[model samples]
Target: MTIKRVGILGAGKVGIVLAGLALKAGYEVRISGSGSVDKIDLTISTLVPGAIASENAEVVANSDIIILAIPLSRYKNIDPTLLKGKLVIDAMNYWWETDGIREEVLDPTLTSSEQVQNYFKDSTIVKTFNHMGYHNLQEEALPKGDPKRKALFVTGDNHAAVDEVTKFVDSMGFDQVVHYKLTDGIMTEPGSPLFGASLKYQELKQIIDNFDHTDFGRKISSTLN
Candidate 1:
């Protein structure tokens, strides 16, 4: 689907940073929090100047693409029906220190995005915007053609959806790496050398190659087995 408007499902740091990127990229942006507009308006105004503040349902219903920047624990609050057939970006990470570890997150058989995709059912769930810290997002992005431009990876089960998000990422000033499936996205999770490091294309690929021959691959192999 052609994505004209973007809806961000959290009003926190990550949500606002992404909203700023989308706004800078010329997309109609709407951001929501658990509270009413009156509660989130100031945050959005100060952080993501052009973004509109709305309730979760309204943001989800009106946008062409939805971004889930809320904590993974709050996934249930998002109505699957509203996300049906939409391109949804899963920008959440499971932090044991904050979001108590859960069985699903630790399940060897499932990638984090896979679990999130299961919940969103028919939505095209693309895993992205999760690896880096929110503070590093805006300033770290180098223009697309810069030789030392940082690269971001995009992974999802749907090729079309992944391609769409790659375009968005490109517009946001990062080079895009496309993984064949959601499971491959684990390379971008915490602990991997590429997780938050601002590396150019070649350096990022080398790290992935190195990671594969080490203990990281053994753990992943066991999980996928």
Candidate 2:
């Protein structure tokens, strides 16, 4: 399926960069921010040409693919109903210290992406675009036919949705798009090479296979602390 239109929910660096790439990939793009329209317009124009800047509802209503490029902490503030039946891409990270919350305690019950999926139950949530930095996202993009291009790992419960996202990832210059079971996304967490470092498909597979599963919750809790 062609991703003809995309709505980016945030006007920050990550959001604008993704929007620009989506536009380059021939998708009609719109961006929304909590900031004023004038400020958003300037930011969008600087980052992405021929893109529209509008209120959140307008962006949501106009686009087929919706990208949540905000912080993980902001998920609670979003109304999931607004994204029902859309392809929602989660590209957020949990920054405990910057969020002014305790760093050592994670809710052992869920990873950040899983929590985002839970919050947006009606939408098809696909975890992607979180593993790389904004600069790398733009600078490291490879041509579609390149043999050494990077791989993008995506996970979601819905097979059809994952396929759609995989195609989008391919269009964005990744030579390989790896699909994993929803629960397997933890393999791509912060400390993992898949988080920010480039790795071949086989290397990524080894990382996943070698991941320690013992007391996973406690392990995550310790990391948070």
Candidate 3:
């Protein structure tokens, strides 16, 4: 899909930051929190000047790409019917402190993105943005050719869907998109060193290369490899 408009499902730090990036990259953005649109109207106006604050369904309806920035525990609350055939960006991590220790998402055999992909069966799910924190997202963006530009990783099952997200990442100023299979998403979860890494392409590339030898990586090799 040619993503012209981006919709975000959460209005928290990650959602707001993503909205700003999408706006900077010349895409129309609509963001929604769980609460009413009235609650985040001012927040979106002040934080992301061009983005609109809309209800969840409205955001989903008007957007070309839907970003799931909500808490991991609340993902099931989203209605999958609205997302049928849409590209869904799963930028959510199953953080225990925030999600209150859910067992369903703790499965080692499958990545969280796998679970999200399963839930939104009809939507093409790509995992990106979740590995980095909101602060890093705000501070790290650099012009496309700038040598200091940070690296971003993209993981998904569908090649075309992933290609679109890779373009989105580069447009947002992160050059050199590192592509991985959707199953390898487990290597970028919270417990993995890659999760919060804010490095250049080559720097992160080294870590990804040696991932199979790491203690944590070895623990999950049977499934991820």
Candidate 4:
């Protein structure tokens, strides 16, 4: 599938930087915040000059792919009807400090992306971009084959969708080193040892290799099984 235009929800740091990357990758990027377009227009102009600041509905209406960068607490509020059949990137993590203690979002049986998938049942959901801190993500992007370049983990049940997002992640100047089904994405979630790690391919791969031995990994494994 050809993905050209990208729509990003949440005009925060992650959203702005992602929009900038998409712009650098030659994709037309549009972004929306939690409020009115007028509220986010100036920030969008200053931080991501080329991205259009519009309402959430407009972003979904005008773009080929939708990136959900909004707070995990607000996921239920995202209108699923407008995104029916859309390819959606779920990039939000449920940080208790930031999103409060959301019991449903913390359901041990599913990753946050899976909860998002359940809500947006008709949409195709791929998970990535949530494990790294926005600050590390900003400084780590490098050209392909660069030694310092970081690796991103992408997860989805659909192989074609995983391959499609792998290209998009590469366009954002990162390598796609690990991928699995969406349910198996617990390895890249908030409690995973890999989260917030800005490591090169070998280092990250090493961690992925030993993840099943980690306490969090075992916890997830037992819960999901």
Candidate 5:
């Protein structure tokens, strides 16, 4: 499916950067903060030129793809009915200091994205845009043919949704690496070796290939869990 409009649900660091990139790529973007539109209007216009500052519902209703950049704890605040049949990108990370400790993510039975999928069952959920730090996002996005282009990993249960998000990622100037399933995405979440790392395609692939055999992956897994 073609994605011309993007709706970002949080106007924080992640949301701001994503909106700016999308707008720069010529996609119509609307970003909403938890507060009223008036509160976010100036910030959206100033930070993300050509992007509209809207309410959450308006943003959700007007776009082809919706990005969840809000805190994981605020997932329940989103209306599933509004998101039904939409492609939703889960860009949230579980931080114990802020989100508090939760057994759902710690249970080992579900990856963080899986938990998000359960909450937004009607929406097509893809796990991405969470591993890299906001500071690296704009600086690291290189053109398609650039030898130094970095790759972003995308994982989801739906192949179509994953493919769609992958194209979107590439359009914003990063290579897209598609993993087959949501379970495989745990390797890219916070604390993993790839998390917050800014690496080129080959370097990132090396980390992913050695993720299981290396002590680095196991150490990060144990530390986060």
Candidate 6:
């Protein structure tokens, strides 16, 4: 399925950057923020020219793909029913300091994307675009044919949804898009070698194949804390 209209759930750095990239990739883009759309219009204009800014419900209803770019802590405030039948991309990371929580709420049981999928039960959720820094996301993407093209990892239970997101990622100048199983998301966790680190597709696959749960446990404990 082709993704034409893309919606972003926040007006923060991630949201703005994604919106700009989506627009650059020839998709109609819309964005919503907690504050008035007017307040963020200047930022949106400066970042993504011709992007539509509106209320959350309007943005969610009008787009084929919706991106949740807000903090994981604020997820509770969103109503999943609003995103029913839509492709939702989870781009959030658990920030304990910002959320004022000592431990990750989804730790020891589910990865952040899985937890987000559970929370947004009605939406087809895909875990992606969370591993890279905002700056890297905007500046590092290279076209598909480029020798040094960057890669992004995506995980989801739905094959169609994964395919759609893969196309979207590729259109944004990602050289390679690795579509892994939902369980593989744990390997791309915030502190893993796959996260925030630039690596080739084969190298990333090797890292995932040889991943050790005990080593992951230590990384999770150290990074999440």
Q: Please state the error at residue 131 of candidate 6 in Å.
A: 0.5
- Give the TM-score (vs. native) of candidate 3: 0.92
Compared to the true structure, candidate 6 yields what TM-score? 0.90
- Deviation from native of the Cα of residue 15 in model 2, angstroms: 1.0
Give the lDDT of residue 127 in candidate 4: 91
- Residue range 1-225, candidate 6, lDDT tens digits: 767899999889889889888888889999988788898888888878889988899998889899999978888788878888888988887766666663545555566777788888988888788877788888877777787777777778999888889888899877444555665666676667677877666766566556653556346645655
Tell how far residue 197 is off in model 5, in angstroms: 0.3
Ordered from best to worst lDDT, the candidate numbers read 5, 3, 4, 1, 6, 2
- Quality of model 5 by C-alpha lDDT: 0.85
Q: Candidates' lDDT values, in order?
A: 0.80, 0.75, 0.83, 0.83, 0.85, 0.79
Which TM-score value belongs to model 1? 0.90
TM-score of each: 0.90, 0.88, 0.92, 0.92, 0.92, 0.90
Number of the top lDDT candidate: 5
What clash count goes with each model? 0, 2, 0, 0, 0, 0
RMSD of each: 2.5, 2.6, 2.6, 2.3, 2.2, 2.4
How many residue-pair clashes does candidate 4 contain?
Answer: 0
Q: Give per-residue CA lDDT, model 2, range 32-86, as digits (tens).
A: 9877678789878876878899888899999988899876667777788998888
Residues 74-191, candidate 5, lDDT per residue (tens digit)?
A: 7888877879989999999887776777654345556677778887889989988989999899778878989988888888899998999999999998987777677667788777
Candidate 3 lDDT by residue in tens digits, 1-225: 688999999999999999998898899999999899899999899999999999988998999999999999899888878789889988898887788755654455666788788888999999889888889998889888898899877878899889988899899889654565776666677778788889898887777767745645545534432
Total clashes in model 1, counting residue pairs 3 or more apart in sequence or in different chains: 0
Query: Which residue pairs in candidate 3 have backbone atoms (N, alpha carbon, C) closer than 3 angstroms, thus clashing?
Result: none
Tens-digit per-residue lDDT, 143-185, candidate 1: 7789868777778889888999988888877887677588767
